[model samples]
Target chain A: MSSFRVVLGFELKEYFRSKGFMITTFLIAIIAVVGLSIPRFIDLGFNRSEEGSSSREFVTDNSRVIIYDRMGYLPPDELLQAYSNFQYAGSEKEVEEAVSEGSADKGFVITGPTSFKSYIYNADMFADEGAQIGRLLSYGKARKYASENNIDFEQFKQTLNPEISSESVILGKDTRGNYWYCYALVIIIFMMIIMYGQMIATSVTSEKSNRSVEVLVTTTNPNSLLFGKVIAGAIASLFQMSVILCAAVLTYRVNREAWGGLLDMFLNIPLRVLGIFLLFGLFGYLFYAFIYGAIGALVSRTEDISRSASGVMMVIMVVYFATLFQLSNPDGIVIKVLSFLPISSYSAMFARVALGTVTLVEVIVSFAVLLISVFLAGFLAAKIYRMGTLRYGNPIKLGVALKTIRRAKKQAKKLAKEQAKEGIETANEDREER
Target chain B: MLLEVKDLVKSFGDTEVLHGISFSAESGTALGLLGRNGAGKTTTIRILMDVFRADSGEITLDGNPFSAGDHWIGYLPEERGLYPKKKVCEQMVYLARLRGIHKTKAMENVDYWLDRLEISEYKNEKLEKLSKGNQQKVQLAATLVANPEIVILDEPFSGLDPVNAQLLKDVLNEMIAEGKIVIFSSHQMPLVEEFCDDIVILNHGDVVVSGRLKDIKKEYGENRLILSSDNYSMPELRKVLESQMSDIVKIDKEKKNFFVLEQKPKVTRERILGRLLNSSVKIEKFGVFEPSLSDIFVAKAGDEYE
Candidate 1:
């Protein structure tokens, strides 16, 4: 424990004083804040109106009627205000000109048969609703005129809305804003575990390379030294990721009404994922920390740490990407398999739990696998650590390490055989003397 | 004994390395562990520090075997270790703190050591930025700062140019005076002579020679002697002494006008001189010579040091 404290203080001091660590922490916080802000911005419905900059829709030619129909939800006064915001264009050239000249956010042109049902938009311009408006107005007017002239208007008018309905039903209990809220919870946990695991591995490799492990191990046991590195690295990750998460939540709170459902989701669930996150985080930490510590010992230098850890890291990266792929296609065989894997389960289960698709049995199975792996990894790691502590300079060959363990077992067997033979010989001699 | 080792044996795989080695060192005495390359000097140190478990040997300190998580042994491995990026004081205090010293006390020890080592200005300097000698000094200070009961240093003089060697020698001398049970290994034979009271030299994983430096030199004194005469045939005298002391090791030779010899218990040096005088031999420059530890080491461990 004293050694662990020594190394812990050593590691924390180094990291805290490092320019790279400070810069990285700052950068990660920025990226997370930006990423979170983007989703909340999506939730805000793009209203720059908080700055009192009202959004407007522009129309030209006969396209005004289509614009009016598409935008008919506003009252007449609001519609008049839309006209003030709008600057009409007579031709395609004029529409482009208006958009280019900052007179319009979007531009449209209308040209068609008398029924008038075509829309054209410049690639650079926003969506065109002019042709849609023209069609609506012409058809609305023509139908009204036809009905007044005692002609049948049944075919003249078509339905304004399409006939389509879709619904999502969550299988388990949920607090709402359902899918997105669940996804956010899942992504955060998945990112944290994987990111922090690599941090632990990288830190171990670096310390080993510096021969810093020698000084550290002298004061602390293998477990505590490794534990501190893993824990400290995780704390750094959590700090970075939390800054981002908080920024996003604050953004949502500011635009509370616009993101009312999201707000409700936050308040209702209070990120139920947080509890599971903390639990799985601790569990997975010990699990991955062991793998890192073992792989770290196998390499003679820091450069080799990356290569030595490559096999496991590749598996982890693949699992991470696979979990991401399974997000949109949950319940696929691959996703199901991932949810069962100890390494992949953190990501997969978080994704499912966020999506409200996990069950109690599945969670239990995941935890069991995680717990078992942590124990086994720790055991194997401790052995490797004990052997590797004094084993220096040369890289530890997998074969040699395996052979050492085998040789130990062989020596035991050989000793036992010798003892047995000696016992038998002594017994025979005793009988002969008698 | 403060530290004891009995029949310690260690092997790597199928190869038996250290075979039933035994030695003990009491507190307040520095022991020089001498060995050639791959001689198990390092292996013994490792076993003693509990870095490697012995195959069959037993080591007990203060009447008890090693206990798990007992943080008492202080080791300075041949390979230097200091967090290059950390400040000297920072790393020193942390190391001191680990050995059960309070943070404040750790800092106080650091300050005193920094001043004692004459690099107090470097207390805040990064280890990497310091001169190599200064770094070595810090490492030395680190080993003793913990006030460990047993301290093991391997090639402690490595990387030290001559001046640093003197500084390190002084520090070691100080440590010895302070009653640290320091077990240090060095290839420099003369150094082993200067510092160690007891030494065990190993060759090929076995103890080839061990004990007090003076006693070994005294044991080699069995046949060595000096002689002078009034007048005698130099050739005849050489022939006679060579025939007489043939069993004793020859150190050097010139002519028998006056020659050195190892006096057998029965042959008194005065009696030999009187006999030479009676035989009409001229006597000059006759005195017994004792070997220095370095000379003795070279004499016994021979040729391999080159």
Candidate 2:
């Protein structure tokens, strides 16, 4: 086997054998399973209306409402029909006193055909009682006007409240339906990048600090060591994430009816969207993993990992927030531009595919750019890792390391050219001698 | 087979660490690489292992250019470590496989080395759980797990007790007997003197001395003699020499029962022996003075010692 494969195999075995990795993955998968299966084991009242109780009955079951009408527009019979918990009061002052003294949960006084005053001891942010009472008063006034004008009240009522049946025909992507899943995917990729990236960096720094890198470098080339480590990390993290996601999606599908399909936007993800997410997420992870590995090599101690990786962390954070903010407007210029950029495209392009209209060409172009960037980053990281292998003591700054690599490359090119020149001259001298 | 490193020059950035260092080692013999700290011993070894490219150099084995990737090289660096949290056998196999050993062979080599080093019982144990000496043994096992044709040991005797050190010496002897090329580097001069057939002493990235151990010692021992008398103490012997043989010999070092004498210009050993016999001093031991490897090392590379 090649050295790269050997190193990769060892690293993967390390991950699989690690108790922390196994336990953490199991715990998160269990959490996802239970969280998605919650509706099956518990009653969330989503089907309450199917049990023969209207929303009004459910909301006003035991609450009392005191009413006082100054204009006498609302008849008591009509008001009682609408709200069975209603009680009459002679004056608005009486209604207020009734509410204040806790005799009624709410009180309303009708002042005009479409206006009302509400009284409550403590206001509830979600209360819609005033709007309900206003509608009732408006109906009462309309009935009275029809009766006085000698028109049939029933016909007038039918004319005023006509019911229409309609069905929606979505012509394009259902942004509202796909919004939650895209949002979730964006966050997942962000977290995976940050967490696994740091872990890769820490592993590299650990080897350096513990002085195992000396043996490793001699045993295998730096490129093999670094690429193997990074690819192993990416695979391990992706495995964990896939387990958790598959658990959630499968459990949610099994209990979709129990949840009344309320979480469909999040759990009922389309396969194509998921495929895009995996592609972008994996490549994005490998790109950052290489950078993180290089950063790890720059530092000689594990404690210096965070300090060395802070710049990369900042970039990831910025990309995360930008992608999240543009989730609702996936078709906007910000998201469109971000979708083509390598660093942001992992999340941005997926979001556009999920919630916005995008062409296959756009996706192919974005992915191509990201793939190229990944390879470039990998090569640079391998170079930096090779340069930093024997360096110890204080952490070398990334800028300084890059400068050194550039200078070395220039020198190597010059030496190669000189050698070519020497070869040519030696050949010419041989020809002359012959 | 012979491994020859000719004009090996290496530099990091603008600072050249190895300046045209040259040495050669043959199969079935051990070469001691002696140097003070920062004398570029590790640098030279790294270049040989292809960890770093030389600024300018040529290395060959049996008349062909040597590429480290094509050969199995077991290198135990001075700053050596293994995964503390990993099983000994598992990591050893991993390291062996990195050198292109198949899994079955790697496992066999790991087991063989672990058994040879007397750490077979700890094969499944985490490295950190072992005692320090046992961990060092595991490190040695890791180095030899690939059954490499060439073995480079840096400070291999450090952190080892006398028994363990002897065990390592015996193992090294077996490798040499097997016709493996061995390069031993250490600060413990006596160990190197006991095992190595040839030596290269480096000072400030330069090879100050390179030759066979016997030849170097013979060249250093010229005109120097160790003399001891049964009847006279070292001071008494020195006094006698000062009084009767001052022109013939000069006392170099005075010890409890012996005197190390430097023969004067054009003086013969026969002349000294005849003069001592006439002086009536009972000569107990007399031989040419051979300098210790440590003495030669200190003489050549001591100025830069930290």
Candidate 3:
């Protein structure tokens, strides 16, 4: 047990001291700080736009509108009621001169009873309050026509537009916003596995190529060495993730009001759902860590690390892509089946649960499968590691490595049994002599 | 006996690397594991250290079963290395701690070994920064950091200069004095001759010549004689040696000025000396020659050693 601790301690020290680890952690921290502060910057920009719109509202409300009744189809009091804070102009030329002199924000010239043209400082204003005034006058004309024809005004308005509303309900208390956070977490897990898993493999291969493993194995159990390295890699990755997560949470907390309901949605993920994320996150990492360690052991040189780890990398890719595809169709039969698979369950089942498309029993079952697979992978990896550490030169295939491990284990057991039997025979002979 | 390996049989795939090889060493002595290249010396040492399983073997320590990990056995493999990027003192402490030494004790041991190896200045230096000879010394220090009871070294003197090699020799001597079982394999015959009390010469995974170094040398009878004279020219010495000897098994004088004659079976050293004197060869030096370990190795391994 102390040997185990020693291995773990030194491996972690090596990891922390490595340049790659430090550089990657620093890069992630920078990205996290930058990622978290983006929303605040965006909110500032948003508030600036809101302030600009509010000032525009004050200008449009207080500014005057002048009317030139050239056709004489408009009455003065009704026109005044139609356009508040209006000034009567003597001619169209006067209205234009007032607009040019900036006395009015807009000008109205009554060409006929139902048609008019306006002079404005900007074309964008034409679509603004001017368009609203046109619609309102048109409605007034329609209502007058309806009243004269003995038609119901309310019925006429209802004919133009009808009332409609929409609402959605899932099986459980989950929002579309929850899916966003779940998916982000899944992507985080994927990226971490790739970064740290490769680190573990590279580290093991470095030790092998450096020939330090020869001395290391003689001092401690090879299994302990493998586990120590894998766990150390895991801890290092988790530490980086936690740093980034804390940065994100801190940034969000400082600007909670600006983030609004989106931040609340992420923060309000049920405790149960968070529990599932933790379970699958930890177990899934362990599973991949074991496989990566085994691959590292099978390869003799650091140059072969990537090529050897690619097979396991491909498996992880499959799981990640399946989870991504399943997120789109959480209720599909294929996705439901994949959710139960140990390989895909880590992300797939978690996504389903986050989307409120899975039951409690399914989560429990899938989690069990994932946990069991982690243990089995750890077992096989330890065996391959023990057998592979001593065998050097060229990368070995997994099949051949497993076979060699089994053979070596059998041979060791036989040797032990023979030694035990010889011991018993010697003891019996001594008894007979006595 | 502190350690014994009896009839160890090891095979890799279908090829038998060691067939029933056995050797034992007691405390307070160094056992020289001698062999030509690919003579199963490493295989034997690896089995003794339990790096690999022997197909058939029973090793005992103090008349009980022995397991490598369960014992305080220090090993320096033929392919020696330390973590090149790791600090020397840190690596030593880590390895020592793995061997179950307390942290404080391990650090003390590391400091002592670094000082002993005259590498205290390199305690904080990365291994790659050191010269090759210094790196080798650091490896040696790491091997002894745990203060193991039995030290197995494979080719410990391979890459060392004379000074460093002598340093290691002195350390091996100290280990033996402390009642540690020291077994090491080396091709440097003179070093083995200098320090080894017993020797095991393996040939093709078989122990062809083994036992106490002096006893093995004695077993190869001293039948050869060298005659040196200050006055004798090459031709005159040849004539004198030819006339004075009968049943001369072999004569090799063209190689040098002195006459080295291997007498026939049952020939006594005194008889050869008397014959040379009776002929008045005016001998300046006369001695019976004992075969060196290399000669015995060549004789035993034959063309393989050649």
Candidate 4:
């Protein structure tokens, strides 16, 4: 086991020093950083477009200025300034020239002698992007009603419209930035967890393909070596994730205003979710890595890595779909089952935590199930790995693999029995010889 | 007391691959394990190396059952493997590191072996870029880089040219000369006869023959003799030899000699040698022949090659 640790560290160092490893890490990290930063740059440009909110208002409607004066919504000085921007022009081209030549952002038109609808509906009036044109036509209709019935605009406001207010309540503890943050965290965790699990698989595959396991297995128990591999993979993943996270956190903090409340979400989430992620990450590693180890053992060449890894990868893809379904309907049967199952649990449980949907008791129960499943999978995988490592020329069949395990168990039992019998017989023989 | 494999029984699924096989090798002795394909030579090697577990057996070392967590044995499996994408020295050093050797010392050993094999130029070159023979040398170096005390190699001469094979043969000889316990498997019987003193030949998952190679070959006691005379064609001598001996099992007029095999029970070599010594049949040369390992295997295993 200790020797395995040494080998693992050597493996990590080898990858870390490799141009491939360094180059890959560098590329991914740079992409992640640039991906985060590019949005801020684009958002900055968008914010510049919204800077018009600070533009000084030029009241473009002459009638609106008079109404504003009566309503006291504007002061006398402001009302007088509104008359300068709002005016009746002879032709529509003059109105367009006024708006388009940086004189105003909007313009108002007043009807002459006909009904207000005819004047407002004319193509000549400059109405805001689209809705402003409809509002101008509707204003003409309201003005006719005001003139014929002797009703004022203030009375219209009082009798015709009621202010509506909305108050939406959240039932559960709200983690700030729940969706975006949750998604980022989930995606990062998901992608990286897959990567680490595959790392274990590929490493084991390489060893088996190269027949290096023959030398290692000669002196060490397979279990100890596997334990070492599992631990190494987890550590490697965590180490890499932490480095990238640190870089991201540092970068985001530099753009604090845009990413404000980012740390708030981290602080508010229950410490229990962290525990869930770790527990889930662990089982995920074992469940996925052991199966990979088994596949790797069966392969005699690098080409076999592709074929065998796909089988394991299919299971992962299914788990991914299960996670997505869990995200959509967390309490559904499929989602519930996957949440409690070892491999799917990592994905589903993380999603549930992000959604603030899972209970502590549920998490504990799911974890318990996961732990047991991991042990079982590990044991089975070990048997398969042991058998697969020695087999070549043809893929070892499932039936053959099961029988091999059974035969080994039976052989072990028989061997123990014979040892016991020999012990007694040797004792008796020793007495007789003595 | 160096190594012991007692009643090693293994089966692949329902079929037995090695049935209660047993053999031992003392320290400094090279034991040749002989078998054709699918005869469980690789299985036996794997079982001994702990890559495969025996159905029923115990492997002990120096009077104690070997603990499973000790990385002290060096094993070269039947498949020759190294990272083809890696440099020769780098791959060798990495393999050595796996066996608990420090990088610096491993590098030194890598340099030593590369120079010894006269392939030092390939040290900094990727193994894939090298020729097949060079790749084999890299694999050979990986096997001994850790300098293990117990070495088990399976089919170590699979892809080597004759010269490269001799180079590896010399390395194995050197390892044995250093008081190491060596066990190897090969179908090249002559090399086995030259390098390994003792052997165990398996056929159809059973040990058909196991002993000192010379003694095992000697056990098949039908002595062979070859002779030729300028005065007589091989066919003419065959007729006369048939008259001289009743135990003639096989007769062949090969390119260089007239060969004859006689069963020991029916006629003694002393009688034949006397006939040759006294006869005026102008003899070119006559000599007794030793049975080969292949002949011993054929006699013991018969047609059950698998």
Indicate the fraction of true inter-chain contacts that candidate 1 also forms.
Answer: 0.36
Predicted complexes: DockQ each: 0.35, 0.59, 0.69, 0.39
Candidate 4 TM-score over all chains jointly: 0.75
The prediction achieving the highest TM-score against the true structure is 2
Q: Model 1 - which docking category?
A: acceptable
Ranking by TM-score: 2, 3, 1, 4
Query: CAPRI verdict on model 4?
Result: acceptable
**Residues B1-306 of candidate 4: C-alpha lDDT, one tens digit per residue:** 468778888876688888888888887889988877888888888777766667787777885666434646667777766666667887777667666777799899899888877799988998889988788777777778888887888888888889988888898899899889989998887788788888988887888888888777666643666677778887777776677654533453243455645545466666767767686567787666567776666666657543
lDDT of 2 by residue, A368-412 (tens): 999999988877887887788778888899899999889778866
Looking at model 4, residue B210 earns an lDDT score of 86
- Pairs of residues clashing in candidate 4: A60-A86, A219-B68
By DockQ, rank the candidates, best first.
3, 2, 4, 1
Query: DockQ of candidate 2?
Result: 0.59
- Give the candidate number with the greatest lDDT: 2
Best by DockQ: 3
True contacts kept of 2: 0.66
Task: Provide the lDDT at B233 for model 4.
Answer: 83
Give the residue spans of candidate 1 off by over 4 A.
A28-45, A48-177, A255-270, A325-337, A356-365, A375-379, A390-434, B13-16, B62-71, B161-179, B226-268, B271-284, B303-306
lDDT of 3 by residue, B1-306 (tens): 568889999999899999999888999999999888999999898888777889998888988888888878889998787789889999999999998899999999999999999999999999999999899889999999999999999999988999989989999999999989999999999988888998999989999887899988877746666667877886887776676565543574343566666777777777776666777678887777666787677778766433
| lDDT tens digits, residue span A1-434, model 4 | 55676656656665666677667666767766776575466654323324333453232333321111111222334334434434344555555565566454444333332212112223445543324333444455555677789889657845665556698686774544454444455566567656766676677667666655665555455665665665666666677777677766666656545443334454344566666666686677667767665665556665656666776678777877667645656556777778777777876776677664667898889888888877776667666766666566555655677887797788778977886787689789999999
lDDT (C-alpha) at residue A68 in model 3: 83
Interface Cα RMSD for candidate 2? 2.1
Residues forming the 10-long window of minimal summed lDDT in candidate 1 chain A: A59-68
Q: Write the per-residue lDDT of candidate 1 for residues A5-51, one digit (tens) a residue.
A: 66666677667777887788777666655654564557444433443
